[model samples]
Target chain A: MSGASDRVPLPYLREAAVALRDTQQRRNLATATTTIRAKRAAVTAEMPDWEALRVAGAAIKAHTLANLGHYLERLEERVMAAGGHVHWARGAREANDLVRGLVRGTGAREVIKVKSMTTDEIGLNRALAEDGVRAIETDLAELIVQLAGEAPSHILVPAIHKNRAEIRTLFLRAFGIAPSDLSDDPAELAGAARRYLRERFLATGVAVSGANFAVAETGSVCVVESEGNGRMCTTLPHTLISVMGIEKVLPRWRDLEVFLQLLPRSSTAERMNPYTSFWTGVHDGDGPRAFHLVLLDNGRSRTLSDDVGRETLRCIRCSACLNVCPVYERVGGHAYGSVYPGPIGAILNPQLRDVERDEALPYASTLCGACFEVCPVAIDIPRILVELRHRTVERKRERSPLPYGSAEDAAMVGAAKVFARWSRYEAAQRLGRLGQGPFVRDGAIRSLPGPLAGWSAVRDLRALPRQTFREWWRARGAGGGATPGEHEGEARDG
Target chain B: MAESARNAVLAAIERATHQVRDADPAAAHDALTRGYRQRGGASLPECLERLEERLEDYGVRVTRTTADGLPAAVAAWVAERGVQRWVVPPGVPEVWLSSVRGVEAIADDAGPRELDGADAVVTSCAVAVAETGSIVLDAGPGQGRRAATLVPDVHLCVVPASLVVELVPEAVAGLADAVTGGRPLTWISGPSATSDIELVRVAGVHGPRTLAVLLVEDA
Candidate 1:
């Protein structure tokens, strides 16, 4: 199993963020996120009981997570009773090896895959490739990313960063088609993908998937998808192996109703996705005769230990948080340097890995509260980010100072000392007012010198007033004359 | 190895439970039952109407007929599409396909490759949700193996009026036996479609592009 520490270091994430400030990437992210946001608003507004449903969704998840060990035990028993084999993997490497072994047992060297973030998280394809097995991604977006030799940038739409023209060029280049003959139309690209993948689907004897929801009572695994690729992979293959994070288990089948409604609207902004396939273990010659379920714990147990951090497990991977996140919109997913991106990634990666390795992730957010509002499970993402930030600071404080302890840390300590007493605070403010003369122009500081330069480079800061509020109040004689309540109001305004 | 991994993770979970305190199982179950509505306030006929309209909205051709007219409707459905070969799963009644002309109904014992060779597939649905315009196939008598409906390029599903319900909950309730019986269920809303490219809705991808649902009403 691989830990979150497998991620690129903090400096890599910072460098990626700096490099991805290109206007083209910004335009792509802006257009895609804005479109999804509008669509989500329209569909969610159609439901009169949307709020009630969200509350129910959160309750069900909380109840499930509180007793995950119990539910997972029940789920294992049920799946085995239904004639399916269950495997427990404590880490990503073990999960990948287990799946590869299953495919090898079937004597097949190739397997078709459904669009699963779990598979990506485990790096299953790369692992399989090392063992001389071919793992073909059948989802159109996934296929596009695979052909372009690029990582998926978005959760729902992996190729969200790529436009139609780039896809057209990629298809033609990868599939040996003449560029002059291929069109950039989406339909044409979809047709080309269908033609390319249909043969692989029919020929492959093994299929791998990730479950959207696994019901413990009925031993059923549900996969929600818009494209038909999932159906082909789940139905036609002789062997099926599904790798799921243990967090995806629900207690009963009836609980599916809450998630079915919440997932479609929140993810794709649709009343229902085009297809949702559910299969228990194996039916008599109906679907795959051999079924395997891998329950992965890789770092989840550690995450569950933190009361405040455990809520991250309730996430359904709907990508609703990603679409509404302003920081994600600007920096894009690649900058996060984790399979899980956006607000959920901000807290999740740091917990899954250690806070020190993914330290920069917590600061990637602006705490705008858009992600929290859009989350179907009502994860207070801003609160979690703040908590993670606190943890990061505490970790920093515990470490001995080396070449640098961070300039911001020194500034914060200095401000804390100044805020301890009123006279010292007022004097510091007066000194700040006088020192702003050189940098201040047209009442705004466009750029700053020395340590503060990085902050002002991207944004403008307004200069301090000539007189402090206390000075103005003393000059007016209003502080001593006004009542306490009225003085409080004036202080609040100031 | 698997047992050791399981033990290690379970030990971790048990340790965490001690730190935060696990809720009682009974209390958690009670809290999970939220007061979500089972059915939208629509009449039976109104629900059925919405199902047809919604399916059609996604480009599925829906035809309504009584049991007596089902045979002819099936014949016309096959003939209009100019299908020369079609396969019917095991449980579909012989009477439904008897009137169909100029088409051969492939045997249920046929392999998936043989099923794929056919132009279309005809099967009866276990349950249909009226509110969502979705059909549930539980591999019941009429619905053969899951691959029967999936392998063919065109699918014509029969949903009896008796089986049509107003909401997802009602449809789920109707399938308690199938659920516990351990049969596979596929809930199809429309023809297999994709919004993968630019989030544009495209009708035909991997599943049957042409889906025509035959709503057989009792005479």
Candidate 2:
């Protein structure tokens, strides 16, 4: 993560522009998101208590995060008592080092992995590879994304952008799968992945994963999945290492009753996912013999300090918002340039990284409020996006005092002065109309000077006409807006 | 290095608490109004019927049987499927497999690799949630270990009618002992499945290709 975060990101608008050119990927995203949105709406609409469950889910996360220090300590104590080793890491590099060291301790040159955004965020595979240890992705979509040497494009379905034929080709090339063994059928592609990873699951000595929820009351770690790859990783391995962001902790065991209902229904739109595994440390005659829980911070504490941004931690990683987001449905996840993507990514990636980098991510959304409406934990994504935008502007203004602020800041100041009095506003309007002659072309202003230039760079602005609305009103004279004949004409024209 | 990291994280959390908290953590947690239903449902027979419906909806074949007919049902399934090797975990009623013939019954506790070689596994459960059609396994009774039911291509789970609960919360409330006692739990809803490929559901992944359930009246 440090490695990825260190590099300057291409602005989100530019990245999204490039992604928009890929019509095939856009089609894949649109179909996938639309399908998931319909499925989620149907399942949620059937539940009478869906809203109440969302409130409860939100409340549990709120309470846990409020007393996160207390719960984190409790979780650590309980895990140790249950015969699991607990390690703490303050950053992504530290986390990777801890996991890599654990794998080294097991003396295993190769390890299997469950699909974990936290691992991807930390760049654990790359870190492990540098140390001569290979981390093999076991989830079918993750395996596909890994084999393609690309970042995952979606949270739940990592290879959501890849079509069946693309997946078949990857499988055929990567696994040396025979055409008879693999086809464009999703079932056959899944079978090919299963057959390929079956041997690796049994042979691997160490496995690393991320926790869906870690119960602090009883020291249990839970993983929710459909493919048994999670089971293979957490169960078959001799040593199990789970890297959990500090925010995943649930205060009590019963809290799972709320989340278990909320998450599956929200994600993949299922009554219940096929498999949900919960292990409290190591158990005799079952699962991994050695259980290691690595509690990761990685800028989470900084995120927690922000009153508005802390709600980002309440996300259960459902990715429901992604399915319903208009921007995400079109531009896809890669445009966000972070492990987390879509609405959640826009807000989360900036908070989890440096303040200066990824400045435009907060502006990636259209703020249609679909994400906030579908969010199970009630994370007001729009409200947070607005807050991040303001914070971004403030940060820029603070860093560079250009008399008033940045170009945006100066523009706002100029507009404030223009609107203070009607006479100045009218005069300025006339001045603007006169000044726009050279720039206005094709019935739109494609470029502008100094303070107003950024807007014209990506989008065309409608040229200001010769007369203002006030002028039109003045011209109306005694012809009031309330008069039916005039009103009819105005309405028809509008 | 680990020790300092722990201390540093703890210190950071302490600082962050003042910025985010408006009330005490325990008090805020206790003050939460759990408006959703905690438990309570229809009659046991009605719950069992609903359980059967949900299990079938997920492609798990559920057989209705009396206590005495459970073993014959297992045998019939084994014969029909032509299962070659089966792992019967410890605590599974020995009489449940008494009628089965021609198949190698693996009774000893088998490791993952050994279970992977087996064609199927027949096991019991701790509880079954009728609402979600999930058979809960806590490595108790007939349920041997987590991997025994997972590694094999087929999983045959036995859910006694009386064990079926009406809701997920009820099933959760009943698992406090398993949680506190350091026992691992697997809530199997159906055969292993994945919807990751273009969001299309394709069943039969690494867990089990097929899942069948025997719903006995009393066992």
Candidate 3:
């Protein structure tokens, strides 16, 4: 994959950051994330050893990633030996072209697709349309997104942003379903979607999917889903194409045991998904006659090269981190302005692309560390964010030539000199206490003008206290016992 | 054209494999398996218990029986489900379903028309896994194709105890020969369901809503 430099420049993140401050976005996120968070917690709590399973799941992925090239080769060999074809795609363009070529080879005008985030990330539907191969999304939420001509907002529940009433309205308007007959009830909405997709599933000759995990040992690609639509798309079609990210590989089928437990709890918050379909290759007189597995790198190799940021590749797309993210709850997935959204998205998107362009994403988090706590794979998100920030700053410094002797630069040089001395730091703190009288109001700095304004926009900053700790310590007399008045005052002030 | 496409794909893989070998010839094929076993995740027995726990947790009952008793046990289970007709994979051991009085047994190879009329489908698994309680079916003579196990309202998969593997690697090893040979394989974990909106759990959205696995032990 070409770097983000080849796409849009970095300023888009700044624009998204501005949009994220909206109260409507925050409310939507808060309501949705809270609901998902509670449900996930309740379901995960059912497993007594969920934490242990999470550790195992993370270790398996780390081991697999370290030996990715090997497992991928094994997977490809097994897939090819099974009469299945495996295609390698370095980026979205190659993947899209490969899929288009396959569809054209089959002479299929339209193909039914199960929901796959990799496809969404690569804009597969649009690419297929350009190639005159209409891609119909059969997943209920995906159908809504496709019908609305919108991008998916969530990994599992793509149309989570749309409420039942809105979905009913969209269905009626888009599919010509009578609004008079439609009810706001979810079951009715689902029934409507089922009816609409049933014909597509039966008629489509080609089906495309994204695998949850690909076991290299057996060359099996597994797709777990609640709706049977994946089953229809996978089994009924004459030709089946599965697009998967390179990171989805697990070295063995047994590794699925840990993930199967972790993913259901993390994504749908289920004990087990209703349908976990695993296909090796083509079956005779049953399922798809032809099977294609598209192994996509699409910027993953770049992600793997970064020692600090490589952990982002461990994500299973379960969105457990997203559900627990305070920032994600506020901004929702769209505000990230990338196919990947939420806590993982914030760190991952900037790193996948040059962070110099997407600087706004690194600052998106409050550094609450909730994401790190909830990550099943234990990706150190906060650490990655800080590392990305350092990278961004370093890149900026390298881009701008430092003036040989500019006054501003010289002042910074002087300040660095002064800061090297402890006496200077102590004097500066004392000066700040005396100088704060002009700005301090009601024990809070209510407003800050200029670059510091961004910090004070949503929060009130506490004014500096009357006495510095050093001053109080000195006033107490070097080694004397603390007086009750002094102790009480310090406690009350704190 | 098919032959050419096949060769091209094979050539690409061979080239990639050669490159990997040149880069790291000592990379262990069994490294992942060893890692998984040592640090892969849960223990074999624990994984099996968890799988059974998950299956039962999802409202599916698990029954253990010997191969000789499988037919009677499955017959009784089918009777209990009130299913009048059942579809059996072409390779299903005939004795397993022979004793079911008055229940019509349809071959898995029966056209979609015949399968559509069946109440439940019964099949023997290529391998049964303890990790996921998953029944692996390759389109071998007895196992039937993917459609036979999926289309029916209820699916009764008989997994020989001896075939049950401790982990996914063990399962993969068992199926490696068939998989590498291009045999069509289907792995079933549980009944199908979808919850589109509001997190309402719905079952049997596309495939069988009810999945029954008869774990048969060798006598």
Highest DockQ: give the candidate number.
Answer: 2
In candidate 3, how many clashes are counted? 11
Poorly placed runs, candidate 3 (over 4 Å): A1-67, A179-182, A216-218, A250-262, A355-357, A401-494, B1-53, B61-86, B99-107, B110-119, B126-142, B158-187, B212-219
Give lDDT tens digits, candidate 1, residues A61-86. 87777788888898999999988999
lDDT of 1 at B157: 91
**Candidate 2 Cα errors over 4 Å, as ranges:** A1-8, A179-181, A419-441, A449-451, A465-494, B18-28
Off by over 4 Å in 1: A1-16, A400-409, A416-494, B19-27
Indicate whether candidate 1 or candidate 3 has the larger DockQ. Answer: 1
Kindly indicate the candidate among 2 and 3 with the higher DockQ: 2
Tell the DockQ for candidate 2: 0.77
TM-score of each: 0.90, 0.93, 0.77
Clashing pairs in 2: A1-A122
Residue pairs with clashing backbones, model 1: A1-A91, A1-A92, A1-A93, A2-A92, B91-B141, B91-B142
Write down the DockQ of candidate 3.
0.26
Query: Judged by lDDT, which candidate is best?
Result: 2
Q: Among all windows of ten consecutive residues in candidate 1 chain B, which has the lowest summed lDDT?
A: B17-26
Each candidate's DockQ? 0.65, 0.77, 0.26
Ten-residue stretch with the least lDDT total in model 2 chain A: A1-10
